[model samples]
Target: MRTYALTVFSQTGEKLLDESFEAPSNEEAKKIGQARLDETGYSEYTHRCVSPEAKLVLFHR
Candidate 1:
């Protein structure tokens, strides 16, 4: 597993939230991030996942 930082961004490009944790893979990290976003009821925004090993790893837009 690796540590990933999840960043939520507004539609206008402002940072909304940041969370860091571990996931087995980038795909799993994205799934977890999307699930987190689903609870927020804000779809207009986008998200990205970053890790020391993966860099700018995942993007859901």
Candidate 2:
């Protein structure tokens, strides 16, 4: 398994949110990010692959 940091960006290109966690693959990482958006009332937020690591992301966006 690997940890990945996801950057959720708004339509205008401004970063809306970010998160990191351990997952079996990048697909799981994306699901983790989607779940976060759903929980935060931003279910429609678009996400992009910023980077991957075994470290936790400090900032939310």
Candidate 3:
């Protein structure tokens, strides 16, 4: 498993959500991150999910 960071930000650059989760792959991390965002109703917010290697698994602006 690898550690992934998921973060969400408001339009004004306010940090909304910053969390870490474990996943077997970057693709899985992206799915988990997107699910979390949907559950939190932040799907339309600026967000990013980064892999342990600092690669972007998912990003939305």
Candidate 4:
């Protein structure tokens, strides 16, 4: 499994959420990240999910 970081930010660049999760692939990471965002009611917020290598798996502005 690979480590992924999921972060959510406010419009003013304030850090809202910063979490780490594991997934077998980037695609899976994206789904997990989105789910977490939705659960936290941050789905429409600025956010990004990045792999261990710093590749962006998901992003929204």
Candidate 5:
């Protein structure tokens, strides 16, 4: 498992959420992010993943 930094932005470029959590892979991390957005009532957003060392990690769209 690895820790991933997550950020979610609304359609109009507003940041709706920021968090850090552990996940097995980037794909799983994205799934979790999406589920979180759905649970939190955010329907449209873009997300980015980052590594603990401040590197940009890519997530499948």
Candidate 6:
């Protein structure tokens, strides 16, 4: 599996998610990120991250 530092920003430009994860692929990384975002109660807001698309990170928290 690959690692990823997941992050998300709310529609209002507020940071709603910040986390690190290890997943096999971008889809899995996104799943992990979305799960965290949902926990923060930003499920209804449009969100994105510094990275346009998920990728495998060599290291993560």
TM-score of each: 0.70, 0.55, 0.96, 0.97, 0.58, 0.51
Clashes per model (N, Cα, C within 3 A): 0, 0, 0, 0, 0, 0
Local accuracy of candidate 3 as per-residue lDDT tens digits, 14-45? 99999999999988898999999999999999
Clashing pairs in 4: none
Question: Model 2, 1-61: lDDT tens per residue?
Answer: 7767766777798877666667776666667766776787766666554336544332243
Please give me the total number of clashing residue pairs in predicted model 1: 0
- Scored by lDDT, model 2 comes in at 0.61
**Model 5 bad stretches (over 4 Å):** 10-14, 51-61
Q: Considering summed lDDT, which 10 consecutive residues are worst modelled in model 1?
A: 36-45
**3 against 4, candidate with superior lDDT:** 4
The sequence of per-residue lDDT tens digits that candidate 6 reaches over residues 1-61 is 7656755565567766666667677666667766766688765665543233443322222
Arranged by TM-score with the best first, the candidates are 4, 3, 1, 5, 2, 6
Q: What is the C-alpha lDDT of each candidate?
A: 0.77, 0.61, 0.94, 0.96, 0.70, 0.57
Residue 7, model 1: lDDT of 84
Off by over 4 Å in 6: 10-16, 44-46, 49-61
TM accuracy, model 1 = 0.70
Candidate 1 per-residue lDDT, tens place, 9-52, comes to: 88788889888878898778777766777777544478777876
lDDT of 4 by residue, 11-39 (tens): 99999999999999999999999999999
lDDT of 5 by residue, 1-61 (tens): 9898877776677877788888887778767766766787653557677776666664422
Could you tell me the TM-score of candidate 3? 0.96
